[model samples]
Target: MEYQWNFAPIFAHSDALLVGALGTLRIFVVCLLLGLSLGLLVGLARYSTRRLLTWPAAAFVEFFRNTPVLVQIIWFFFALPILVPFEISPMTAAVLGISLNSAAFSAEIFRGGIQSIEPGQWEAGRAIGMSYAQIMRRIILPQAIRRMLPALTNRGIEIFKMSTLASVVAYVELLHQGRLIASLNFNPIETYTVIAVAFFLFLYPLVRATYVLERRLGRSD
Candidate 1:
């Protein structure tokens, strides 16, 4: 006997999936913003000559980069609440874990992008009487950003996928909703398949965009 496929039951719970998708988007946006912005600061610190700044930044990058993101999420959700006065919500824990992990990885990307510029570009800016901040803003970052687009896009896609991990802590997301629907309807196969298709639909465009960016940058470079 062959397995019978039915998607009608899953469709009946579309509202749950919509709620899960909203949760996923909420987390993704917050994490991406925090991660990239903080990463810029951390990357600059890592690149600095001052030991005061460099040491802590280096330690942060290493710790977050080396450890598993899942462990970080669990730690924030369970362990940190024990240490702190306030309650740690699932959203807060997920945001902290994903954002920090992304910051560590993105810090390296930003640092590498900044460093790739020729030293003469810095000297030229200094000769023109530009301050360090002015030089970075006017001369360096604009160029580096173009080079970093593909990598950053890839990071964004990674963050999107990482949103699913929130379900581990019972944070509602696409996978979490799918699990609920599956359990209720006894249609794990169809439910999970829909979830997978949803992810592919979300990520495929990003993947294509990365390729396009790479090609355009290649031509411009």
Candidate 2:
């Protein structure tokens, strides 16, 4: 048996597909931004001298890193209302699920980056009579962040690709729309081929940038 390939159905829903792709990009960017901020704090806490700070940060990383993001999405979407005062929507659940999971991994990246900085740099800040926050803000973070730029950018790309999982929550992102279109048109081959091309066009550039960045970073290393 041979399969027919027709893009008429896809073309018919081009507007919806475009909207879905844009939605996917929007949520991916939002979650990555949120994850960046949260991960920075968690990373710092991992380097903290206080047991209280380190313990909680460690637990957070372990829980998110070990658990399946799909489970987290379902839990937040379905079970959160019982434990929290506010009800969570599918979009919110999807964002939180991927964002927090990215944060855990990003935290480790940042922790490694910060640790890569020389200890004397911290001492220099102290010698100048700087507070812990001041030292991190003025001296440590700027340098540490520079060292971690390549890793952080790569993480952003990873998070962007992971946004496909949002489909499970009915968020109407790119992959979700493709799945829906395939089901409706019964043209799985054509539908998924377009999806693959779309993802390739979107992701290949970022992957290239990552390679370029890693090369530049390696030169500095």
Candidate 3:
């Protein structure tokens, strides 16, 4: 039998698709910001001379990094509600789970960037009588950010892709919306193909920009 490709049904529900994409972008941005802040603190802890600080951060990174994100999302969405007085939304679960995971990786990126700085730079800051905090704030982080940007941008794109995982928790990102529309219209191929193309179009620029910046920075390694 010859098959007809029908996209009309999906486009008829364009509003839903748009909403899903927005939700995806929302979670992606929120996760990136949360990961940045949390990862910085965690990275700082990992770099600390004190074992007290390093151990917990190391544990945090290991737990999140080693665990599958799907399990994390499910646990947050389902298990946490049983333990807490309030209900947890799937969107919140997705954000928290994936952001925590991203934070673990980002922490490592931050640690690497921080460590890559020359020892002389640290000593130069000390020679100026800068406090540890001042050195970090004024010297270390500024330099580290240049190194971190390409990796972080790549991470941002990865987080954007991972937004599809939110669908498993029933948070309606692009994939979830596409799935529902496909089931409704009996055109899984058309629906998912569009979603895949949309993701590619949305993400390609970011990946390209990161490549360009990495080349410019002479830190492509």
Candidate 4:
């Protein structure tokens, strides 16, 4: 027996899907900004000579990197409210988990990019009477960032997919909305297919961009 494919029901709930897409985009943007920004600070700490900074930063990176992101999200949503004074909403929990997880990963990318620079670069900056901060801001980061572009782009793509995990906590992302449509219309096939297509449509260009960035960076180097 062939499964009769029906999409009309899914189309009927287009408004819900649109809302879900918006929710997804919101979480993705928030996580991307917070993650990469925090990652830079954590990466700088990890790269520091001081043990005080390195120790805590190292622990954070290790903890997040070693643990599963899904668990992080669940813990933040379910367990954190007990310890904190304020309530942890689905958006807040999703943001905290995904952002911190991405931060741990991006920190390594930032650290490696910075370390890939030659020692002579630092020496040259010092010879020019530049302070550590000045050298990093003006010289090192500029060069390192170019090399890190592809990796960072890939990380952004990953963050976009990670937004779906928010659905587990009923955060009303694309997948969450799809689930609602599936359960109601009893058409999981058509519902999930649309969701998959939506994801592919959104992510394909980014995947292509990552390849382009790699090629350009390759030629530059």
Badly placed stretches (over 4 Å) of model 3 are: 1-3, 211-221
lDDT of 3 by residue, 1-221 (tens): 98888888888999999998898888888988998899999999998999999999999999999999989999999999999999899989999898999999999999999999999999999999999999999999988988888888877887888888889989978999999998998899999999999899889987888788777876554
Candidate rank order under lDDT: 4, 1, 3, 2
Per-candidate clashes come to 0, 0, 0, 0
Tens-digit lDDT track for model 1 on 111-215?
A: 999999999999999999999999998999888888888889989999999999889899999999999999999999999999999989878986897788778
Q: What TM-score does prediction 4 earn? A: 0.94
lDDT for 76 in candidate 4 is 96
The segments of candidate 1 whose C-alpha lies over 4 angstroms from its true place after superposition are 210-221
The CA lDDT of each predicted structure is 0.93, 0.88, 0.90, 0.94
Specify the poorest-scoring 10-residue window by lDDT in model 2.
212-221
- Show the lowest summed lDDT stretch of 10 residues, model 4: 212-221
- What TM value does model 2 have? 0.90
- Which candidate leads in TM-score? 1
RMSD of 4: 1.7
lDDT of 4 at 68: 83
- Which residue pairs clash within candidate 4? none
TM-score of each: 0.95, 0.90, 0.93, 0.94
Q: How many backbone collisions does model 1 have?
A: 0
